[model samples]
Target: MLQKNVLDYLDSSAARFPHKLAFADEARSFTFGQLRACARGLGTALADLGPQHNRPVAVLVNHTAANLAAFFGVLEAGHFYVPLDLQMPLPRLRGILETLSPAALVYPAGEETLAQALADLCPVLCAEEGFAHPPQDALLDARRGRVLDIDPVYAIFTSGSTGTPKGIVIAHRSVIDFTEWMADACQFTHQDVMGNQAPFYFDLSVKDIYLTLKCGATTHIIPKKDFLFPTLLMDFLEEKKVTALVWATSAFHLVANSGVLEKKVPSHLRTVILGGEALQAKQLNRWRAALPAVQYTNLYGPTEVTVDCTWYPIQREFADGERIPIGRACANKEVFLLDEHLQPVPPGQPGELCVRGIGLAKGYFGQWDKTRSAFIQDPRNPNYPDLIYRTGDLAVMDEAGLFTFLTRQDGQIKHMGYRIELGEIETVLNSIPSMEEVACLFDPERDRIHCIYTGSQESKDIAKLARASLPRYMVPNLYHKVAVMPHNPNGKIDRPKLKEEWIHGNDHRL
Candidate 1:
């Protein structure tokens, strides 16, 4: 059957696995039947609350089963969901709300105070109350009938270069295509239980959420606090009998670096997929050593590409210093590299990674200018309108058509009349046995390269290693050692924060 709406996934799964747990959190869970009931009921209420159709419905709540229900509920009501992280500051949240101008704002019960603050912007709907509303089948069916594959399903906000967040709007077709390809590529089954680590607001979570619905599998929303203690996280996965893990590379690195996997591993974990940053072989080797039989996949793409356009299933052993290719493009998607002139780069040369096909997002919501800047017409085609998203990420394609991500376009800087990639320096430093984490930044004002890292090695030793490996200009001009590396909410290194603190704020130590 052709799936026009994402709700179709939930409806089919609900019928097939009525009594099975669909989503679960630490405090509560929802069976497929019950989740469908909650969604229908909430959909009816949302339909009655406003007359808006195909608009954004902002959902501000913690990561829980109820939150997932709210997401489906928004879709059931014929509008796209915009998940807002509860931890987001009011200023940023306000900015997003101002830009979204959603038809309604859904919040968990007992958060009336927070909800009320934004009530002026939109109608506030209590998720708990909405779940209790009686389902209007005819009304919901009518709404569902109106939905189309090209309509937006959700909009996830990502940081823009200009400081404001850009809401990346994804259509149902894009997600449907991506999710279908992911399920087939990853070989997901109903028996697989997923341990979801990415926050719902982040696009990475899309795979865990939709894949479970598509496969009729169960998903356990691992608590954010569990990630801090690797042992506790492993225990949760073990207790839940989680067979799959869709996580960020940082989360994987945390567990491997913590040495918890050496002592104890998630015995039932069979598949591990990582993204949102480069996957270092040092940490990956640790996981492979611990779970030799487990399938490991490295995914690459920005949020604008509907989660991921390329994936590399680990096939052979890699040394700690080797780089893993992101592999070929996924089904129903096309990924290619283009140089600054918008021409295909020669094989093995770095170029901006561009993506097209069914998996590409609709574009940024309410920011047409910004959207036009990133999502442009395919230069190769002038006769017809064919769109491709410019990812701004630099990567190199090998002779075999496998892509190896290098760094962000901004991460490549001109130093001493030579263009160098910061990621290359970090990759080299990361290969060091004693180096735990490393980030390279450039100081344009002083014309120096700054290397901030958390490792046991002294600054002098790291400098010596860099001198031996990198060219004189490519070697870091400054090295700062810290006990711990800072990360953002999505688990990627907070380079901007590190730059503010280590590079711009204090340089005396360097």
Candidate 2:
């Protein structure tokens, strides 16, 4: 049986499968024993810097074997790890640094420029040098002894509407609970080989990393470029003998839409779990037609409630236009809907989806007000100490208790398994000197982002600036420059009219 914390999972797995391959990237792989040794070495190095337990350790590195070791190393040092995207613009990265004020920053060699800039905030430790030191068993053991299951394990920053990124703090218990339920629910085993598709900073990768480690399974870190080339991705999956894939819906669509799956199908794949956006039956049909034996599931959840709170296994076929149901809540988790007045809505009535369970996060780091507002005391439960997360997602429940996703009740959109706030795009665009006004629209049917803006600068130039500040998924693909933005009677930008005009006129430049 898995223990109550992630560290226990690590210790037990390393003891059981000391020589078995645990994690890998494009460059190399690590055995369970080697992973533990490297993490212990880094932990001892970190402990030498002094005791800073309960503080955050910023890890700025690409998705590689070293990065994986550094994550466990942070925990081994009695601190939580915060993974930051190395591609983020310095201005935006600095903003996160201000909010985090991390105890130390860990990065691979050759990032000295970034290390120096943030050195004023905290010490910068090079992972290359840290891992070179001999393992100090006594120091690592002492640091690990201070750790607790309820303590924060990681804090992932997601796009926020307030022109800043919000860090979602998750504890060790939440990961343990979610991973335990996921293993049994998905039927994961030590013999399975898992392919990782999500980035380390994204919440989806949490399942890929922890579940693989806990189950003593091998994890192949698929490269970013391979996803763009479906044929190559399929070949790599076959080469690695990846039997399970927990990827975003867009990834599967890319293969089906690009006609790559027609050329090659991943023969070893047994389980396909898709999330981050609603799955179209058309796309699902393409995969089902090719691989009849594989099990397909649709997962749904926000970062605030861990990776996924609900799941739907695809057993029956659906028409092209039909959307897949998000299914029922996972074991040990509860999902219900509430109207605008915070009262329970009857079946078939649209309501805001709320989730309550052991999978819930610890709330936004350093933003008490924001955390309290979104994660409030459950009004429906007066007898027990209960808290539920208002998911900001509008959904309706059928007679069978399956949830059909309606529309987002907020400015957020899930693209490529990342929850993005459209306001974050406008915030970065509005920062441009020549930008007069900006609005971002999402056509869910097409899974595309349309940007309508009135600005003196060239549209391409605006996009260039956006690319620097925002992740690729959040950057608008279709750009439109208009003489003036449409406004309603209230003098507010008429987003509906703008969307309608774009659809009718076909004025998008790209």
Candidate 3:
């Protein structure tokens, strides 16, 4: 029988290579059979929660083997899982809970305070104790049989235009399609060893997780703290013999320039995939110079689309500051440039990049208004109605059909592989007992978040307040106090002018 759901991958892998290592983290490792059995046990334990189709079971835990079990468990119970980052602030986490209103909150054991605090909103399931019950084979088989490809497998939350975070739900069919394409395009096999870097909450982990499962490859989860010491990271890679790496641009830059690659090279590293941000030619050259035989690729996509929509395998050398093309769209998917009137733009002209295909998300979890606005009807296909996601990113396609990114059409920025809304940071800054205006800027060269504001509160105090409300990545690294805010002719904040002045050394560092 054809596999219709994501859970089927586990069942097939367990049967084919029951003793083969499926996934390993710093704490422990799990074989294919062990992973499948544990997930089944977890599903049986969560059966009483009434996991219906489309309902969400929010999992709040760190990156660990237990978290993976919770994810598969939710799918086994005929529901979707929303993985939350435990490091996020409580206020931000609460806001997501309010927006999602999940059926239950799944956390690790010994977190009684967290469970009690969120118990009022919904039930909390402990991962350590939750799966203690034996596998209920009948119930698991029944739910598995009912799940369809169109039903959502998981939901990820991204920074919203509004103050709250928006949940983006992806279905099993989308993952199945993208995973199949990636496996064939990249030529993955059971002999490959994947080094997982991105956190489970982030969408980048999707490619690492699903691709490993589809190819029957082993994935070793590098600890977060290891990255701080690049030499230790190199040792881990050398020890695990990681052959493939799908990581953020920052992670590649950190390792390539940390001097560890020059001193000691990863003997088994063969392929390096970068996404979540633009890859600088200088950074690419540094890695290539050290490991000349490695295959490098630039993958681009938003959370709305399953992981990546387009890919560019590096073939030729590039100079410093050169713009890299995002290359063509993936198989079975089409990405074209569309003008403001929803018409096809002329070749070589800048326009919004619109994507049309099955890889698109079902829509925002529950925000009908936002979902309808972003995912609209394809104007060119009026004869038969079809939906295409209007990516707010602007780009230009050349005669060769390759896309070169221009700039973001909105205030959204990808920092440290996280898609953050500048407005979200400004909202929190405005709430901090401030006197006046504020603006957030992402410095691509330095990879820093800059916050400029005209306020009475000290920058240190404001930073402290922000730390309490926002995640560490969203907090501004540099704070500047300006005397007056620049405005355009429309009397609105001239962000361009502010960014120019900040870069040109016209403002005082607070």
List model 3 lDDT by residue over 50-146, tens digit each.
Answer: 7465578899868887788789888878778999987778888888888888878889877778877888888888876766768889988888788
Q: Where is model 1 more than 4 Å wrong at Cα?
A: 506-510
Candidate 3: Cα lDDT at 324: 75
lDDT tens digits, residue span 273-305, model 2: 988766667667878888999999999999899
RMSD vs true structure, all candidates:
1.1, 10.2, 10.3
Which stretches of candidate 2 lie above 4 Å from their native place?
161-163, 411-510
| C-alpha lDDT score of every prediction, in listed order | 0.91, 0.83, 0.82
- Model 1: what TM-score? 0.98
Error of 3 at 420 (Å): 22
- Which 10 consecutive residues of model 1 have the lowest summed lDDT? 501-510
Tally clashes: model 2: 0
TM values, all candidates: 0.98, 0.82, 0.82
Give me the candidate number with maximum lDDT. 1
Decreasing TM-score order of the candidates: 1, 3, 2
Q: Write the per-residue lDDT of candidate 1 for residues 441-488, one digit (tens) a residue.
A: 998988989899887899999999989988998999989888889988
